[model samples]
Target: MYVSLVCRQWYAVTRAVLVLTRPVVWLETTPSSQLLPQLENTRTLIIKRPQSMKHTTYVTWRDGEIQCWTETLNRLRELSIERKIKINKIEIKRHIRVDTWLIPLLTYTSLSLTNLELKDMVHREIPFGQMMKLCPHLVVVHLHYRDTGYIDSICRHANKPEYEPAELPDRLRLQSLKLDNVAIGRTILMRILRLSPDMEELHLKRVAKPRSFANEWLNTDDRAEFSQHILEQISSICPNLKSAHFSYYICDLRSLASEFHLAIDRNLFPEVSYWSFKWCDLSADTFQALKTTPNILTTLEIIDDASAEDHCQQHLHEFLCGAPNLLHLKVPKTLFSITWFDLEGIVSTVGHRHGSTDSTTTVSHRKIWACRNLQTLHIGFGCEGEIQESAENTRLIFGYLSKVCPRLQDLTIRYSLLSLELNRGFCLLTRLHELRRLVILTQCNNDKAWNVDWISKLITPSLGARMKHWAAEYSTMNLGIARARHPFTSTVKNPLLHHLLEPSIQSTVNGGDRRGDEYGHAANAERRKEGQLSQLVPDYFINGVDMRNLGQLEDIVELLQDRISKDWQCWPSMGFFELICLESDPNGIEPFKDTIRICRPDVEVK
Candidate 1:
């Protein structure tokens, strides 16, 4: 607005640029008709409940407050219906029930809305029939967190809620519906599904009590019967659904109803190429069943709540052997291919723990991974055995992966656990020409082990290879920001630096063997002559970054007590540090990205 004031040319350009961005309109602030030019694009609107009503419960909301919002919405109606500012999307993110404002909202706004999202509802009842009829162009809908039982418990003497017409008037152009954590009735669920017969995606994270959707009185048989009906008809109903994600919740109900996700029911997902499962309690039977089927999955993710590989019936082996079309597979757990060994002393009663093995199992059946075309792999790698044997096994694993999944671009693993030795383990990954991102999650003291030279070696300039992103996050977090005293001399420019970081008084930034490793002989010579960080290093990194190596147990920082170059600062809690440089490009988020690109597009900086 300030820049546009210079001339009409700037205003015109500003308006044109503003038109590209989806502008937000606050429903409470009704502007005068003179400001009509401001709201030329009425695509998305945000309405908030009156601030005065924040402390009050929904049940006790005065009619005055309700009228305030309704009147404000009427102003928006005048703009849309009369002024012809066509509405494209309306998302009600308010925490109150949908029924309170939705009916009047529909009456007062244009019915041509293409997208609608009402996810944060406190009550279950919503007029689905009315909403679809009002907005026929609605393509995507996200309905969630509607728990009427919660309302009854919170508010005393609450009247029994009436669920108005749950059926749809007609099939709209709805293509996607994400229903999660909702306690909706069966009629409502079926109605919503049938409303979008040609739906493309269904993300049912957790739809509790499908039986409660119909039955006023619920039982075990109600759940079992509902689950059976869902498993049989879900596929036939949404015949055009290309992607679907189904997961379990509320143990008792899940055991009875959500059996569609239990591995054996391949018919439930006829042609779903992209599948994901979170805390689905998947076991060896899940992958074993995939082997018997005609595998068409391109992406598969199964995450456990415990993350303890308890079910070991060919769990890792099954996926590697089966899914030939697998491109992206992420099961965040440490998996070992070799069998007959207790890992981490986790003795589980679920699967058979082999106490003995034949001599023919010298290789332990650790073969090449079957997912040869895998591009994105995020899983824990572990080798359980003798030291030399473990190193050999790791070598085989990486060597095989390098050959098999040459197209692999994204890889995430633990730092110390991977044991990525430059020669034995890490060197095997040199053949992976397409690898772009290597994210290693480190525990406490592993950050200083890898330096710029190691990174350069990993990038392998000989092959014209370059890493797009290299991130290593320290997992150990500090609860309190304890400002400890510096172990080194406090006279190092600032006392706060010494106190906060606790660096050794005997050493400076480039003192002792530090100079030899950081930049090799070049930095070592410079530091030897200067013998001070003022000339060799800057004050920004004195106590500004992860100062554990400078001598501290954990990463420490004092944000308010700041003094240094303004370009950089560190907050250990947020996983921000000065080390571990990121490779920059034209598409990078830095302010000078565009200028740097124009100046030197070919030059890469980290």
Candidate 2:
């Protein structure tokens, strides 16, 4: 029998003890009653006092100041090498204020603190410059505070009369900084940039919003000016930065575009490679700026909640056309039109002239002009119109790509267009013989409407003998039309026998056929059933049946067999079949299985 660790608190305590023991050190005005015995052999100790000590909660910083806390903390410090002192955060609940306290526990332990976390320090009046001068050995700093009033506090602290160097152990050693929802002014942001030039990663989330207007700077245009200011600050501060994520309550694409444009113009980043834009308004101009960004952007993602179809299409086209180096692109399911984008100058001189890199590689009377670096294409959509249009455009785009993007490997087509006429259009892929895998997603109803015979005849042979993998997916609704109700069913019936019978049937009928059959004879008093205008002749259908002249299934099968003999190579994998969600009944399952298995034993029935 095995027992689960169901009690979370107990499990946490057990796990913490098993990891190792470190000294409990607290810096405060008074010593604690219960000292941590584990600290007796500790190698280092730190104590930071809290603002108040009125609360007696167990986890509160004030609880560490009791006499037992002092004893246990001193004991632990004597036993281990690393000491950590955490200050409790103050919370006001129901108009009641809770006080948190920290007490000093000094020891001669010599362990160097490799990691340090400071919380709830009253920095309202302390200059940021002074605060920096205090934490010298800090490798990572996380500053969390209310956004409404914090920036002013930091600025006020920075302007204090006495100048103090930031106590950060080594300014160059700090690798990461996270400022969470803290109000930050432009001056403070600049100071941080100046202070930590060597920092590898910086995250400023929910930072202070920029002023609405600035009088002195040029480019006072509402959208462009504010965006330029933000971009300039980023480029100036984090030039070597690799990745930066900025998400706000709301952000306009123009602002982001201005920033990216500034980064390109200033050559701000040589190493920055990944960028993410989320919930930002993207326009044509914004996309234009992305194309000019100087750094090599390997991955670009845009996530938007906008529902306007026209805006979505415009932005998508601009991004595809301008961002020549982008390799992976992801847009909303509503943005499928973006995928249908054709490199403007693939086949014509106009396309090549506009193509990036001026690579003159030409083949098959076509040239690839756009997205030469694009290798992976991921798209999500609910309909097929976008895909059809994209396929048509891609036929032209791939002509020039042979030499330019020789490494192009994968193509994923996902949509629900299952109409016979449209599925037939898939034969267009014969042009990309270089493709290794072909994924056909039949999740949509349209994909299920495929006539297995049509796909087998059209797709298999056109794809050169080099093509190896073949996949056919069945949709939930097979969308199969019955033979009798088929539009051409009447035409396939016996022509001469039907003409001979029509005259005889009309002789007894008084009125035209009530069933609306195109070639049916008129109804008569003998055929009518009381109030019914017309009725089928039960005796006439049994004795007057037209089977003598009607074509038989075997005859049709024989003809199909002849066509198959000549076209077998067209569907080399015809034997393999898969049926999905087919009513889950033996009746629904057996017929299709028996039919397909007769022609191809490898047929799969599901």
Candidate 3:
């Protein structure tokens, strides 16, 4: 029965080898009795080797192999002796905590192995240097976890030499090396630098956690010595290194302070520029740290969580003070009010969490007068100021901006009361030679009042007037037709004549009041009460013709176009009227673009 089971296992092993072509394909092994037929039937089990196949090998735990007949095993060993078949790659997995099974394949054959990965194999009391001596052409090596076991094995093999033994790979010319969770003290870092001289990529993850001695060394001198060790590695070993990443503050910040200075001393970092970090604390001293660093740092994003506001502000102030080649600057919202000393090389300034100032009563209006090359400014006004205070402040702030940042193109003032009148402080905005687009926004539900007529008159008069005229003409015609049964009533006043004649709407529209007769319905009165300005015309005009019903938007457009064509010299900028019906609230503007488009096709809704 045991013999039959061994035969079945050997057959399974032979079938597996026949299907798998690669020699080093990792697999779980079965019993030893299945070994003979598996090796003999290798030709039948394996596929025809690819013509381009340079090398192929197999690797698996000894236990994963099937049991073979004793007669087959003896025959295979004799065949190897007779035919000299060299194994290219071999891996003996130590599943049952066994030492590496050293085969005679490396000693007898001239075939050299390039890729070697010894995974859970017991490193029998042998130095790592000795293992490399067996395989000279090794390129990639991975030593992950179980470091203590391997270290114990290496110390056992430490030979008594005239000089101290090297702990790292010196003979092997490696390209990639990965050490994960491996306990490496300060000695290991310096050793790696000397050994893998041609190494390009290095990942020391969680390796710094327990091994970094700088954390435990309480004496400043001990910490300084530890820091010096790292600095020497960077200068001697990683001189040509293009990329580097290290964390957990393993080195003393005070000892290597000069290294930070030397980085920008020469024009060294031309190709190396991008820097990103978290929880970086730079006191007022940060300016001295990065002042002469050249224009290599073009884009920088810093997320600082400093307890002191001045510390954060001081760092940014210094960085911007010197970085003349910096094109874009993105800072936190808290620093906007911090009065920038030198904002050179910076064309754009983005302030996060800076739009509103509602709770604070007295906001000292700060102006950015230094940025001469500054073009775009986005100010987010907080919900602090009441309508009048907000409007007055807006005028003052925009006036300052126009004078200081003359080359401004696009300006967006968000969440504040918008004033069109160039009140004392606002007149300076007109001096901005390059100002083209200006946007003012307020909350969706806030009662933020803005005189649309005033803004349209100032920004785009031709389009503005056309919209005003259309509304006025429509209202007049509608009022004329919808007069009351008693046409001369005081309540139903003449809405149109009140505005054109100018003095007062009550005096102008109350013409029929003396006769004690009402003219218009309750709906018209409701609209008139909402600050509806009036206009005057002669009494002989169309009686009850209802011009509002007849005057469609298209008709107004055609009328304006005709007038402009006939009198182009008189009305140069005035042509077809373009109406942009903004959401009475700021939040509604974008969503209500369709509404404005449907009403006036030529109008720019957004």
Candidate 4:
């Protein structure tokens, strides 16, 4: 408005540029008719209003707002109408009906629209076939219905005899489709897939079982059969599909087995390189079939299924042997207890070498090789036992990985117990010079041996010097103790660690309100009290330097006093030193505090 107001000449030039660029236009309230002309060239449009205004009365207002912008949507390439309210206390009712608001928008942008995202839509009978027909040029479509019940209702409506099917275009331009909590029938889902024959990625989450089956057994059987059929059809129909994800409440193991079998038999999914199955069970036969399949998967994630661990472990080698190019592997803890012998076998197989049965070879001469291309490894142990029993095994795994997987950059381990021995095992990871990010989730025992000092020990000079990011979470249920801490030492040459540790002034003032109050008092009196307190506190220095500076001296004194008052009599650990340094700043301490809070909310940074 200011530029246009400069002069008539300026107005004409600026308007023309605005028309050509057509930047994103965000509307929070009802768009007026006058504003429609200005948005004629807009490429992206977003309509998001506050929850307070998403009431029944505002439905008409939003409907008119969308209708007013219909004509201008002809040139629109992307549109997102996210009216879903995220407040936990408020129950969201239908704000805008899809048929009334969404269908018209689709019709208007039918010629040019490429991306469409409809989030938090109320459960209703959506003419999906007709909607796809309206947007023939759509390349990406994301729909998140409220729940599976709504999807069940839609499935029922679509299957009705009175429902008329729309004619789909000869070739769809769609490349990606994501549906959350959708429960359409097999036929309806197939119809939708048929419309996107060239899709490259498909993600279906929380998909409900069809309701047409009479009994639980029949429903499970039918679902499995349908799932297998869909995979086969997708392989044939969408040969370009490269990635797929599926998640559900009850997994059909038989269906998964059949799907893998069909993929092997028909040599399907040649182009697919990524697959994720959440809360799904896999049997030994499925793994056998997977091994037979020729697909060179780059990433495979199978999580949240404890019952399938034994089967996965028994056949994982076979399956992985087939996928020599696998780069990312995520498996349950139960399936990840790989022995030294198993490690050697995998190395030999991946490197295409045959090793001797004799065990006389030295560790160095025994060929450090396996999954050379693997870059990311995530293992979840599911909180079954203490880490003490498996400490040596876990350590050996790390030692092996450091030598074999030279390209490994990211590693994540969850739900394990940690002690001094385990920390030492982690230190062995220094051999992985390429490693950039490391995350460990463990329950720390209350014993003095497991203090925060162990964290510094894990970051050996070699690892600490190269590691870009490292995070750890520790808790003591026996003592009702929890603490989250991160290392932020600037003296270290590691720029990543320095950036992570850099203090924020605002967090310091906020986290140190009590100390800030004391500092606000008369300087002489505060110094006298600090001198007295310093005598009672132990002599401590950070990074081998005595704290003579005012900021460092004040922070340490306050921290000791707080610990003593709380009756936490344990000696100050490295965590205390880091906290004191983080709280030394009055303006820049939030990022450090937030890293600990978000990673381990139970641990008190104070």
Q: Number of backbone collisions per candidate, in order?
A: 6, 70, 37, 11
Model 1 residue 152 distance off true place after TM-score fit, in angstroms: 11
Q: Which wins on lDDT, candidate 1 or candidate 2?
A: 1
Alpha-carbon TM-score of each model against the true structure: 0.51, 0.38, 0.30, 0.50
Q: Under the 3 Å rule for N, CA and C atoms, how many clashes does model 4 have?
A: 11
Worst 10 residues of 4 by lDDT: 504-513
lDDT of 1 by residue, 22-45 (tens): 546443344444334544555665
**Top of the candidates by lDDT:** 4
Error in Å for residue 96 of model 3: 37
| Full-model lDDT for every candidate | 0.46, 0.39, 0.36, 0.47
Residue-level lDDT of model 4, residues 1-606, one tens digit each, is 334447888766666445423334435454555445544445565555455654323434445445554543442323223221111111123334666666766665566667777656664545666766787667887666664343433344444435525434555677888776665555555666776767898877656655433223223333412356667776777788888766653454233554555665566778777776653445566556545556767877775555334445545544653454779987644334333233222222222112231224422222222366788887654322332434434444555565456577777665343322323344445445455556554443312332233233223444333232121111122112101212112122345554554431111111111221222235434555777432111111111112211111122223323333343322222122122221223233344344444434334443
RMSD (Cα, Å) for all candidates, in order, is 17.6, 22.5, 24.2, 19.3
- C-alpha lDDT of residue 385 in model 1: 35
Q: Mind giving the per-residue lDDT tens digits that candidate 3 earns over 1-606?
A: 122325866857655334223342222232334543344323211111222221222223233232222333355456466653334444433221223223232332213444444443233333345455556665554443333322222222122232124544464465445443333444434544566666544434223333344233222222212233454454566444433323223322332334434443443333334432222423334335445555455444343333334445445544553454443333322223212311111111133222222222111221123344455555443332232433334433454455345566555554434443322223234444455555545443322232222222132456446545654564565454445221211223457653433221121232211211133334345644774634322221111111111112222333334333443221122213222223543453433334434433433445
- Candidate 4 residue 462 C-alpha distance from true site, Å: 14
lDDT of 1 at 12: 71
Candidate achieving higher lDDT, 3 or 4 = 4
